[model samples]
Target: MSSGFDPLHPRELDLPMAVPLRADGALVDVTSGEAALTMDDGKIFAAPSDPAQLDDWRAQLVSWREGARARHGVPRRYDDPASAWAARCFTVAQVWLWDELFFDFDAQRFTPERFLADARERFGGLDGIVLWHAYPVIGIDDRNQWDFYDVPGLKQAAAALREMGVAVFVDYNPWDTGTRRAGDDATELAATVRRLGADGIFLDTLKKADPEMVAALDAARPGIGLEGESKLATERIADHTLSWAQWFADSEVPGVLRAHWFERRHMQHHIRRWHRDHSEELRSAWLNGVGMMVWEVVFGVWVGWNDRDSATLRRMLPVQRGLHAWLVEGEWTPLAVHEASVFGSTFTHDGSTLLLLANTSDADVTYRPEGVGWQPLHAGDTADLITVPARGIAAAMQVTGTEPAELDAVRTALAAETPARDASFPHRRTRRLAPQIPSRAQLAPADIRAGATVRTVIVPSGEHVLTVRHRARETGMYDGAPYVDEWKPLPPRLHDQRTLERVVRLANPVRVGVAEVSAAEYALFLDAIGEQAASRDPERPASGVTLARAREYAAWVGGRLPSEDEWQLAAVQPGFRRRVPEVWNWTESEHSDGRTRFVMLKGGSAHESTGSDWYVDGGVRGPEFALKFLLPGLGQDASPSIGFRVCWEETT
Candidate 1:
């Protein structure tokens, strides 16, 4: 590992954080607080203790921005109205492209409207959505990243999201070198962006796209904002309109986000993907006058948001939407309120002011703004003190002289409504959807009855507790989140090999095929059904078959794909054997949590992508090993390294 730069666990010194303002009005570029892996894990922002001295600190911040502009020659591209949407996007969801909420697996179609509705109810609504495709599934096949985006209805989905006032972003994986060779990444990416008419590019595993890439993507289409994965470079912030805070630990006083502070229009989204408690990230976003990356499903494991955070988001979204000008372009006051674990910021534009409050403590804190005409926009309806719940957020608005009808509508709607008190995490656990197969055991295959018996091994009917081993990849085996409230998962724990115990029961004896179905066998089955399929070799094991298609072949053979347990049971039997050039065997252990769907594969494949722990684990392995492969949509699940075996039930 060159430089020992662990993406899962980044060093504080290597991270860029909120620039703390020294007491003497000098900006100190500290790497802690608002930059640490979690809240309070590093030094706090070195600002004046007294709120009265904030004016000087604010002045110094402005001066530093001016100096940095001259030092780096900041073009301030945010001035262009073409990418104005980036500035106004307060909430952007990093949704798995095949997330059940976004795509209906049953219907085999994109459901953008359904996805948006969930966002509206649970987390107010989305301003932008990054369709996270490929990664965790990419290295499975030779098809590169662009092929995932080039899905049949991806453009339509992007158009639908755009028409609904939600900006759409496509994820660009720069580490996709092992896949099929394609045109230059820049050219291919630009073409994909142009074809999809995307509004932004989410730079996967990149702090900033290289200058050449930036230029190519810029020329792809107008208003194409680029969002880096982690804390973006200081100088690049001018051109890259957006980036998010990952594992950022804020000060007791909630330090300013450097990017947003340096340029008011430069949007910074706060995200801690693996953590279940989002209060810290939300607080950072709230104080920074920035956005939040709503990632319910991290890769494939579900680390969904809690009720309190979602409610907090719901409370502030209306105000943020109605007073977008004040929130993004208005004068920003960091630490506007810093009393007893409660911190906030004030944004004023024209005659309207919006106060965004966050409570870090575990109890409600009631306090009214220290001025008249402060009306609650997300808390108590009246002009009285509003309550900011424990580890929650609240908001209030003030009209300087006159109240605009639009602002009045927001106030009226959120007036008097109390914040949701439930801080319980809403978890989604994946469960195996065991399909019932029509037993055709009365007679063997026609060829077998005709003296061409296929080799088989039997798994007796009974409960068998099996020990299954798999790497602790993000695509967790079976169910439960891989990381819960974890700020950072390092080596030995991040991708370490782990074991699971599964007790499987079979109602009747199952006869599993000794070898994977050959390309010739699959071809015959298809031709018998009046269909055509591509096969590389007639004698080789059938590969590049989707889970659905595999199920169809198993059914056509009067059988079903073996579950991981059954496969394991049959593997150790004397008669069972693997086909030459082994591939992952499809199992009936298909699972879903209504948001993500995954399948369990047995008998590891020979194909493995080197250079990244993010790639699916590979190499030939025993039956004890299980691969929890996430099912991608639009024929992307078909991989040359994946195939299936047929199994049938034994009867009297």
Candidate 2:
């Protein structure tokens, strides 16, 4: 980073996501900066709050749309009949493939039904989900990004999700060039998509796919939607039907999402993964007649939705799912009615008008628009005025020519499902698994060390504060989001070396192994226990073992895996040593925030993948350096670049 680069306080990221159209026929040029970060929306956009300025603003907006379409040749959303799913995909979610809610660890199966059931109950249901498989955990070994998706039964999981009417999207890590190669990326990705029967591909890191990738995916699945992570270029919007509206800060008077406004059928799923308050994003999506990305578990961190946002999503989904045509094809008007803190947008089509209202204020707002025969879609009885919940949204429809059956179903569902008023942030803390101190742990250090399998170092009992070093990736180690409300975390704020202090408490002395358990020793243990151990080197530390396997081995020996604290404490001891080929050692500090599971790893491996910042903790690291590894499902936790050290809580 240069002398003045401050990633957290990037001025450009704080700007509005909507382009401003001044009344004086002047438009800001939005295509100045890098194509990935810059879109149709100029960074410093200001939406008009005064009602009188809206018409001219809208006229300029329309003119810009016309000019942009002319400048950039049309692609797919306009005429392609096959790419119609984008319009109806109002609500999508991004979930880790190994999310506890999605995968059954004990059953050893993908619980698609359970996942879908929870979604239906909480946020009505999901139209699609991005099964985020790799990156963050990638570069752990020689296994490339594709290997994560190549897990056994993964195809069956995708098939099951599709069977349940939920579209499955496989994530593509474009920056995964340094890891193990499986043919070329395009070919490997398309083949994986075809084999898994995936409907879409989530492009990680990139805003849009290159022509070659796009062609490859199109050949594999003709209508496969390529949804990018952040902003999508204007030219690419024709083909990439979906865009992720991540970290897009809207104006006080909600501004239209640039992509959605440019092409009505283009789906922009509004999401701020780290933000605790989703009311703003939900409201913005509602008024724009666009989409919302429900990301409860963001990169193995629990940033789950509150009751209020979930209820709001539930209220909009029923109507949006049914009358998506109105949102995409109808006449859309933003800021149609301005009632102080309450703002609304009206969508009209076929003698019917739908009004989506959002109250940005803290208090409940009542608005009486000059209208008749309005059927409330927000579960409200209004002879005159309708109440839009505080910091929430509401919708109502007036059908003139033959009331639609879809509207009736929507109304019925909306009436039954009451919206919640509570907008409090739902916080879930990651709890560390309790360590079972065996009888021998309390004995003198000499007694515990006498029969140890390897050289051991004692971590004395007491309160000790130690500094832990980690890279500030999106998976903020054991806490809230690292980037709250900040847009597009840059290199300085992301993947930067940061440290935090951990105050550890121990009741008794524990002996941590000086060296990681060797393969020969592990094979011997397996033989004694009548367990089959295969493909062992005999000399190297036991690698490619799961946390469960490591724990089981420790238990059999009347000991346990060392907690990260103990490992760090014993690392500087005189007898502590590392094997010839170093590998990350799994610790007992496994934690769960209910939605996601992660464990700590001490030391670092030499198997560092080059070419991308998305890889796991790499290079030979010091004792204090720890990696927060999110546990993967489908027996994928057994990584080759990882080994273990036992902390003896030896039994009598």
Best by lDDT: 2
Task: Write the residue-wise lDDT of candidate 1 on 1-652 in tens digits.
Answer: 4465555544564343343456465545433334222312222243455677677666656665666566666655887889788988989999888999999887789999999999988888899999888878877756788888878888999999999999989998888887788799999999988898889999988889998998998898766799988777677887899987777666556677766776778888888778777787777777777789898888888888877788888776777767778777788877778676787888887877888888889888887788788877764445778788888777877877887667777866566445676777777777878674433334436764332356788899988999989888877767787876665677776899898888888899999899998998888766766678687465689998888888877877677888888999999999787777889998998899988988888898888777667777778899899888888877878888998888888887
How well does candidate 2 match the true structure in TM-score terms?
0.91
Steric clash pairs (candidate 1): 34-249, 381-415, 381-416
Question: How well is each residue in 524-639 modelled by candidate 2, as lDDT tens digits?
Answer: 66675567887467568898888887876676565789888999999988899887589999899888887777899989997888887888878889989999999887669898
- Hey, what RMSD does candidate 1 come out at? 4.3
